[model samples]
Target: MPSRTPSSALYKVAFLWNLFWGVPLLLAPSLASSALGLPQPAPGLGELHARAGGLAIVLFGWVYLTIGGNPRAFRPFLPIAIVAKAAFFLLVAFVCFFHRELLAMLATAVGDLAFGALFYRDWRAVR
Candidate 1:
């Protein structure tokens, strides 16, 4: 096989991070259901969250491992991912708003914004 570039190594590392963190989140719904004796979500909802979370993890890995070290290529995806993350947080905000779940709302909103800031810094550094 051809040799991997430094950028590729960076991407691989990022991918591994996602893969490592994502597995648990992927299993969380089922674990929650079983461990907490909570009713399980409909199969569709469970599948959807699993798929989305899995996709996010994979995407994060791809970006981190492949593009992270190559600022030029990585630059383009940064804004898009930030926006997507923001939207995700907004969705969480809406859920919390509707449900009046103060803690969840605070956590999601703050966490997402913090993540966005971190991404922004990374992007700027790369630039």
Candidate 2:
């Protein structure tokens, strides 16, 4: 059997990362909401974000499974994911140091950086 390629490994990493990060957000919406420092979602918005986040977590898991099975399909989204991850980390870092949020934004920054690195590695494999 052929050895797993770099892109394939990267996809596995990305899938795992997204699935792991999304789980907490889906399972504990109030905790997530507290970390973000937003007012408690109004009844309608409560349902909206919870449902959306739950759906997103499911989708992320599905996408991860798909990519793990076939890494080539991840090509198109790699660059965009990397950029978004980087931007997210930067924002988190800013908030962690300057905004004084309840939950340490540093964790978010660390996660974003890890995901960004994985995406970047996959992008390079394609080039």
Candidate 3:
């Protein structure tokens, strides 16, 4: 098993990083989008989409928080979440590459990939 300290530190970083996105997203999706330079949705469907996305992110963030506290307890979730993060990064990157206006959102893609790598490393180290 990997030393608990290094793995734990990675998990803590993951937890905090997820929180950084979750809080703003759940509280104010528009502001979060603005900060990321992502395009805002229109008042009707756009706003609804943003809000819904925010809710989803909050739920995912909760999962990250849970796992960070006890990776072994939540070991089963590790692979799935790691893959999801990787997919998210790829999806965002693809979308941004096609849409110039969404280029700023690439920052999140980069962050997501980094976190996914760290999460994978920590999870694998245990075995």
Candidate 4:
């Protein structure tokens, strides 16, 4: 097997990060929201939305894992992943800016920004 590059390692880190938050959000939306310093999600619709978000996050993690396993083969998907990260970060930052109470989410949003930058670096490197 070939040696892994920094980009591969980065994606692996992202995978772990997603799992760290996604699992709890999936399993316990209200509890997870509280743990993350967000107000508890309401029942029914709120919980449903949280669970859906969690599933999306986990799926995104799977994409990162696949890309890490074969960066060249997965190169085409990088743009979409980068866009997703950027969009997530932007949305969170926008919300947090308007609602100070959601400030705790800024950390995770920043993480996505960092990953998006690293992913862009990887895209350039591979190209």
Candidate 5:
């Protein structure tokens, strides 16, 4: 493996964070959503959202971990990561803009944006 970059720490942080957030959603959607200040989904919808989102997050988290190991190969994915987070940010912003009280969900988007920025910064530095 190549030597670790300045952003290696950031990648690791994002990896762990994603595990923390994603696993629970995959394994315990109701609990995770409740803690996040999200309303309960209609019966089956909970599992659908939880499992799907969790899978995405966990899978992407693995990608981030891979980047930590071999950024030269994975740094190209940074832009996709940014798009992922930006999508979340925009979705949350739009929803919260109308609901007003569900702003707590924005926290997740904030974290995503921060991690995305870190990835972008490191990708640029390495290039």
Candidate 6:
């Protein structure tokens, strides 16, 4: 087994962060919404959409876990992961700009932003 680097540790943290949001959102959308300080969505379509989003987050966490397990082998994914994190932050920021009530999501946005920056740093170091 290869020794873990700080970058690998960061990917593990990212995986955990995604789980923090993903699992609850997947299992209980209304509860997750309330926890995140957002209005609870109606059942059916609203809940379905929320669940879908949760699934996507979980998928991303899987990618992070893979990278964390073997950063050198997953080198090509580093840039893609950074972009995915940036895109998520930007999307959340855009939505929050128009809807102040959604500001609670800022923490998640910021988390992605920080992870993106850290990933960029690691990518630079390797190159």
Error of 5 at 63 (Å): 0.8
Using lDDT as the measure, what is the rank order of every candidate, best first?
Answer: 4, 6, 5, 3, 2, 1
How accurate locally is residue 69 in candidate 3, as Cα lDDT from 0 to 100?
A: 79
Q: What TM-score, to 2 decimals, does candidate 4 have?
A: 0.93
- lDDT (Cα) of model 3: 0.76
Error of 1 at 46 (Å): 3.6
Q: Among these predicted structures, which one has the highest TM-score? A: 4
Each model's lDDT: 0.59, 0.65, 0.76, 0.88, 0.81, 0.88
Taking all chains together, each candidate's TM-score versus the true structure is: 0.60, 0.65, 0.83, 0.93, 0.87, 0.91
Residue 7 shift from truth in candidate 5, angstroms: 3.0
Better of 2 and 3 by lDDT: 3
What is the C-alpha local distance difference test score of candidate 4? Answer: 0.88
Instruction: Report RMSD (Å) for each prediction in the order shown.
Output: 7.1, 4.3, 2.3, 3.2, 3.5, 3.5
> Which one wins by TM-score: 3 or 5?
5
Residue pair clashes in candidate 5: none
Off by over 4 Å in 2: 1-4, 7-9, 32-43, 50-54, 57-61
Error of 1 at 88 (Å): 1.7
Model 3 C-alpha lDDT per residue in residues 1-127, reported as the tens digit of each score: 4365325666666667767777776677778878887766677788777778777766777787778777888878888778978998999888878898987778877898988887787687554
Of the two candidates 1 and 3, the one with more favorable lDDT, higher being better, is: 3
Give per-residue CA lDDT, model 1, range 15-107, as digits (tens): 675676456446665664444333454688776686577567666656655556665666888776567557767876777676663444456
Across residues 1-127, which tens digit of lDDT does each residue of candidate 5 receive? 4643655677788888889889988888888889887876557976887778998898888888888877778778878877887787889889999998799988888898888777777777666
Q: Please write out the lDDT profile of model 6 over residues 1-127, one tens digit for every residue.
A: 4433545778889999999989999999999999888988778999999999999999998898898787777879999989999999999999999999999998899999999998887776663
Write model 2 residue lDDT over 3-39, tens digit each, in one string. 3365455556666766666765677666666666644
Model 5 / residue 108 / CA error / Å? 1.4
The lowest-lDDT stretch of 10 consecutive residues in candidate 4 is 1-10
- How do the residues 10-50 of candidate 4 rate in per-residue lDDT, one tens digit apiece? 88999999998798999999889989888888899989999
